[model samples]
Target: MRHAGRALACLALLSSLAVAAPAAAQDDGVAPLPDDFLWGVSSSGFQSEGNGPDSNWLRYTEEQEDKEDVGASVDFRHRYAEDIALAADMGVEVYRFGIEWARVEPAPGAWDQAELAYYDDVVRHVLDAGMTPMITLNHWVHPGWVADQGGWRSEETLRDFTAYAESIVERYAGLGVMWVTFNEPTLYVYHEIDNGAATWLDAPWLFDRLARAHSAAYDFIHEADPGAMVTSNLAFIPLTPWLFDAAFIDRIAHELDFVGIDYYMGVSLDNLTAARTLTGGLADAQPDGIYYALRYYANKFPDLPLYIVENGMATHDGAARPDGLSRAEFIEDHVYWLQRAREDGIDVIGYNYWSITDNYEWGSYTPRFGLYTVDVQGDPSLTRVPTSGVDAYAAVIADGGVPAGYDPVVPESVCSLIDPPLSCLVPAS
Candidate 1:
């Protein structure tokens, strides 16, 4: 295993170099957000709309007691209309959601027309609600046939993914939907590698294959839906420089029409000296870190229209953070930073909170990042309870931005040194 200290230091150095560069030179900050900025919310089929389909993740959660068995996650499969209605009420112009590959392709060479009809209905609903549908081609789930055929590790899997991508885009060509070829491809590869669920391919090779798959899908999507924009969303992890491969970026750069960045936690390489570091410290959790992280990617991919495709703070069981950073405060803090990024000339076209409601978070239901919390374990009705953040987000969507001078309402002492400097700070109330 790599030494954590050494790993973090290298990450910090890269981050410093990235930040020191001029944003304009980086090809970011040149374009203002287009009038059609796709402010939106995001959800995955397996994670949010729980309708059992015998996925590897489902089996993993059920077989492992330590993992949270998300049997009936917000039940979006049954309640998409209600959930999407909530999103429409927020005045968001887009709804980014995934169509599970496993559900559509339950067996090899056998596609379910009903599955396509379901998504067609959902996509139509989104359009009817006055929101564009941004569909993710694959959100880390594969058909059982592929899983049985050694998954993405197999060379055949790459061909399968390409075929799958081509089929879906061709099927839904005229829906006026935007397409995300893949969601967090790096994380998906990492998860498969770390969990021993896949073999025969390492990270580098997996990335190479993914790059090919994305490139192929990119062309197909454009050919299928000439008006559609396409990209492969990247999971941004600041201070983990090794996680980034410039060569891979170069390869996919031509293939992408825009950049989808999923910024979450922040880390600094200078763990010992920096006030904020990723090493189990309060600073690691501060929302300003998100701003810096976005700026970093904005600089990295200067010419591309950037969308914060996934971002949200997690709380233990939807409980308030010790620092008094409630869900509302978290949303405000992140939004303030987002506005700052925009003012600085980042071509940020959209923002999608990780989820509209709490769902199965990989293995655990405890770390809730939802605007509405779902009783995953206890409630038979599985009601979605609105968090304090729900009203805040609704207001943000209505205004098309965070209220001017919005800052977290919590006391500075709670965040200690990690709190934003009060010099230009203004309260949102």
Candidate 2:
């Protein structure tokens, strides 16, 4: 791992030098992306699909006044066909979505064949639409029974989670579906802790349980589907350096088949940027931070393919962003960095926009991060309106990259110290 990190550092340094060359003279030529690069969008079962299920999150939203009531989240439960069509239209090659464990296993040892069948249908549709289906076994929404039995802190809950994962793999073995064992295990831990539900606080014990659950599920997924590629996606937050330490990252690095990253907000420990409140300055939320965050992980796992499993900007009540960073600009800036990361040899294989549409954002709909904004409140149409980002993303997908000569509008001085040589401006051909 140390050697891999060192190699990444050298590559970054070289790339920085390369970018300093003149932009016009640069190759600016097109290079073929990886043959298997996955271009897709992501959505969680609880967040987008509006079907009532007895899960910890359902209870959390209902009981917590501060959280948004996600009664009809874009009505994906019924509008899946339309939403999926939107993705297909965008030339997406993959669709990453989650299965609601609570809906599938309403009670202990009881399986809902119908729920499984529903997913089978969804996956089939995705395939028919010329896209692969990437499924997440758990996305922070555990069955209420497991929560009742003490959640992640309890050995019983861990056992149940593994068992559930095994069953899912067994059921969907030949579907050509990529599997994510868990979405952001660290974030899951934080959620448990924040909600006063975690069983362990210390790194050793907490990571021990996480490793146990991930390893068991990893083995089971491969056993069930010989071709399955599985991982536990991490949510990248720039502010949390301790979370990305060697101990925790190395454990995940060893377990995952690929590195799945959920990058949204950028951070700078050197500059000491405080966490912004829901309502704050938009310019302060720069996407450049994503570049460093990706570098942080790419440096650790140089050989493994990296997937931006989740990336998007949030708005308050679907309103125009106060800063110049509109939804369209946010998507464009993020994609630009994504291209830059790949150009720098990060082994990044795919980019999945955080969501297909607006849904319950864990707590509030106010933090709208959807390409197509859906009004969860008031409107009976349960309308899913295309935000400005929709057109921007459509063009990006169609072009298979950002437009030629496009540079992020951030201050050039910000990156002047470490900017890649002007010659590096050429898009990977």
Candidate 3:
């Protein structure tokens, strides 16, 4: 962790230099993106697919107080086909989802063929819909057996995790699948600490183990799939990336084929929306902050491409956001920034909206970020109601990006803390 902090110091200094550097010329209009730019939607197995095998998360939810019962969440386990078709109908180019470790390997040294076959079916459906399948190998849920062995705190769990990763890559490698070895490894540690799986003192050891797991899995994925691109997406924490990326991303920096970033909010002296992060509630929209996120990564990993593995707006239980930003405006506003980043020479290859449908958000289903809203609590049918974002996203994809001279519905924040002195000193246009 100390070594990582040194690396973070270097990165922080590099970012600080942006304050002295001149901002790139603001383009008068956004141009058409490259033909291969991927437009996709994202979801995780534990968050969306219900009737799941027992795991650390399931146990945590069971024991925790005041958590919403995540019963048959959007029932994606039984209704994936319908959901895949919904995405296809919107001309989505890719479908990013997770293959649950608990479901496929419920016990140590044991495998479940039925659950594996279910994931096979899900992948086939996505391909049948003429979309690419981006599979996340872990989304912070492991089998109860692993938890019993002390979760990520034990060396034994790390060994087992690598084995599971190899098993999954071996199975899905040939299916033209893109792989995410872990979803937000930093956040994974935070959640584990929050759930009593580990203590703050254990964070350094846990991060080391996660880095080892991802590095081993990266080799296994490529050895099996050859052409497969792999990443463990980072949940971009504005202004303080060094605090989050130091222990994980810095360790596995060399292992990544591309940088996977999930940017959902921004902080500023005036707008303290980031405080909501502690509660998993809807944060205020910071559309322009995404440009800084992209630019930051573009500078950090100049040779590798950047992908927005997860980006979207969350509303409280399908209702409009308190800030009055509509789901549609959020879509257009962010895409506008994406185009700007591209025009400024950022090599961004893909953008996957945070989710296709609303599902359990870690502890509760209250923070809804899905493009297609679902009534997980009230509707027995689990109806998939299209938000205005549906049409907005489709149009963005069809037109290659937001049209020339488009203006964001939400204005850029003043003195944004997203990238510290850089963002504050030289705000993006």
Candidate 4:
């Protein structure tokens, strides 16, 4: 393919990046990122929507303890204009949000006009705010009708999903928004299994359905608007990335216009805390993990552009991190590595902080990963409080990144397993 050769050429030109090489070793501050870089934040539907319609997650929330459903979560469902204004004010050029299938298609063949109009306003507001909208078609929540029909396990589910994609793409084609066919497909399956929607044995069958759905959606989206970008964001598990990729990326590689990576933490011999977060603690983080994730994918899929679709720190309910890292410090540290990845000849075109405001995190709203922390359960006002990250990210957007020679607040760890065999051998000093 055209990109295969480009990937090889990039690898040859950037072999020095094989080590933890900084481009601005002698510079004053970190170098400015490319002018065209896409800077943004993201949110999902079920997680942020308070008065959500019937879906698998809504049902799951009812069955579990410590699982309380707070209405309208920061009220993004109604207050998206305020939120979009907030992101626009920060100077971010993109806002990635989901268009929930459950909300759109309440039943198998029925599509709601008002719900579609609501999203129409949301996308319009995003563009009006000077931010490009990255719209996700499915973000782990499907209509209860689909859930009842065996979710991803049934062939009927894929057919209905493709129809949903078609309707959405045809409706939004004029907006020319970047499209995410599915948000984190690996985790989608994992959640399905975890939520008891499917069994472990159903993974392969589900993947098969998801792959087809994505490919079909990719085609459908393009046919509607050829200029639109389409991809399925992958959650890059720091430890066994190959395992994760095999589970999904390899299956739908050709259909992707770019690689959307949501990298949160890294795994290292010393940084086993990511394991804690992976299991549910959401406590551990390696700020520089973005570099490793980008490098791995750039080399693996050289031809395709890479987008840091989701990357942010999670704290325990808006509390200061136990690591004593401020969100400002955290943002700077991560952005530094993002600049490093770009300097290494990786075609990283965009970066989005995981969320615009805090919302429900799967089972609980305890682990907060928002630039603006909203206390869903504790605060009645549902105030969107700007963390240190808000100003820090704003500064990054304004300056195109930190200044030249600006270093991370935290340095790369020795024996870092973020890149496996190579990272352990040629660790950053």
Candidate 5:
């Protein structure tokens, strides 16, 4: 196995020579991103924000989850400056965080100025830290009032979401923030289903509602701040991507200014172990899958710039992986493929690592996906322990991109379905 530091320097082969014969040799070298490329890290307000508010997520964590209660959740509400400083110290360009709708509008038409002011301070810190704030308007947790009004199931909820989006836009547009209407709307419905808040039959209804919400928000944001770039990022599922996501993706395609993709795991060995086994080992983290994800969207939205709004590896409770793959190696290979995709002429504008510190993952704090691990359930200090990946990411940012001709420390899987024709027809070195 290659050491993480050494992996960053290795150049085994740029690409398979035979694969690129019709075009140019893939083994030559991957090109650097434009000097102005945005490298960033992402975290969600609902997931990271602690000091429990009166929201659906707060209720879920306290009552529904079998795992640990989200006590303080690394105290991001109070410690955002430190976390932002950690990101800024890495020399990152963007910091993607959400403005919690639940927090801002705690009750029906009862806006919380304190909550809004807290976000104002957070955004200010993000800019002062020298990072562009890519603001997400929602990350799945809604006000308890909205849940009582039927969550996404209620037609009234659509108007409520748009109003909330409008309020956020009016306040923050002048701050020069990039806007995300929603984070993984498909996954939002999935979470609701998993939490027994909705059923499978409700997915289409929820999706349609989300689409309207996004469309309304897109127009609202544009009118509020002309030339605002907005998108509702999707979780890029390799399997059934078209089968499941076409309804929403197709509806919102024309409304998006950029294609925001959140890719984590992919289908491998014909089984997505991550889905079946959430024990939090890095089960199906196919770094090369990032290449196909970028390609899938690049081909689909030929003119739009693509941003990796969220991507990272997850270990079980910040434990060392049994597979022996270091976080640094995972990150390097992930970026190497992203660079390869860019070199292949994808209009890739930015990439953000999933998170800066470990926070509550939907229902569990065990699945750790962070450069700096925070033991929310254990350590009283809630120390931000640096993983090898932190250094790996820092070097990547400092250097602009990986070296030209650099090889993936992990080899591409043969016959992988992430991009079927390209996987077998156009081989990777």
Candidate 6:
């Protein structure tokens, strides 16, 4: 482990970066990120693509009384051209989306060519739009057949998932695509247990299965597409990264080419507002925690690059956030910290905003996190309305990042537990 000298090395790198990197705008603070830094948008197959497939999430929504029905969510399956165009218009360089397992393989060992071709069209469209495709193999939804065969509980799941990953990678290899073996595997385990798919006693076994799946997939993805970047993104649970990352990320750290972090909210000693995520309510925003998240991962995996796989604020039904934070401000605030992270010598390479349009958020359509907001339940047409975030994001991408001298809309929290003692002792500039 190179941790012994990491702190001093990081300090030295910070000083060197200050003198070496040129500022894009105002010189005192935030500097322009590298020209090759990836700016992208993200969406998952299950959440954005309407026309339901037989899957665990569909069943979860149907069986649970409180869960809202996911009826033709934003109809991305039919309207992807418009959606991709919207993202391309924003000048994004990457388009990250999932290839739905349930939709592609409805039955065990059976692949649907039509569904596969639909994804082919989507990828080709993205390429035509000049965005690199980032394909996620699994995003918390598997075929109902897989779910019926014990889901992640049985050891058999590991083998089946690896096979599924191999098939997908073979199809998309050499297409200049980035691969995410599994999306937020830790949260995948949480949702499985939370939805009664598994029990608390089965948590460790589930984690092991996911870790094994990712490790196996990593080898094959690289075998098929040499020099490919592969990772299973982790949802950054502020203040308790160890609690969340321990079982999953620790198990597959060596296999990762880059650290993929999905950060949304932060919690402090005085503010436990992040609890809202548990109840499907909009979590209170803490933009500065993003800086700590990057710093933490950079310190732990000093040799690997970092990517913000997903980061965006959520609103309830297009309503103003209770904290009065707009999506536009959220984008600027987070990007400002990203620039700061890079200036401090973090090997940060890319960022993908959570989504292109609002869709069914897990079991409910209440929380909206999209650059172009959509009224999933109320509007039959599913029109994509441009939010203030659209203009803000376009400007951010055009300028290479938030303007220099830019400060976050929400100030850093006191004694934030994002990185505990280190974060509290040495607050970021």
lDDT of 4 by residue, 170-242 (tens): 9889686999999999999999998889999999999999999999999888888999999999998865677
Q: What are the lDDT figures for the candidates, one per model?
A: 0.71, 0.72, 0.87, 0.84, 0.81, 0.86
Report how far off residue 331 is in candidate 2 (Å): 1.8
- Model 5: worst 10 consecutive residues (lDDT sum): 5-14
The parts of candidate 4 lying over 4 Å away from their true place are 1-29, 427-429
Candidate numbers sorted by lDDT from highest down: 3, 6, 4, 5, 2, 1
Q: What are the TM-scores, per candidate, against the unseen true structure?
A: 0.83, 0.86, 0.94, 0.93, 0.91, 0.93
Writing each residue's lDDT as its tens digit, candidate 3 over 1-429 gives: 755664565457556654223346556677778889999999999999997778999998898886767789998999999999999998899899999999999988899999989999999999999999999988999999999999999999999999988988898778889999999998999999989999999999999999999989998888899999999999999977766777788788889999999998888877787787677556788888888888777766778999999998888887777689998899899998888788767888999998999999887888888888898888888899899999999999999888888878888788888767666765565
Pitting candidate 2 against candidate 4, the one with the higher TM-score is: 4
Which parts of model 5 have CA positions greater than 4 angstroms off? 1-28, 268-281
Candidate 6, lDDT over the whole model: 0.86
Candidate 3 or 4, higher TM-score?
A: 3
TM-score: model 3 vs. ground truth: 0.94
Give the Å error, residue 189, model 4: 0.6
lDDT of 3 at 72: 92
- Which candidate comes out best when scored by TM-score? 3
Clashes of each: 3, 14, 0, 11, 0, 0
Least accurate stretch of 10 residues (summed lDDT) in model 4?
A: 18-27
| lDDT for predicted candidate 2 compared with the true structure | 0.72
lDDT of 6 by residue, 21-114 (tens): 2233335778888889999999999898987689999999999998988889998999999999999999999999999999888888899999
lDDT of 5 at 285: 60
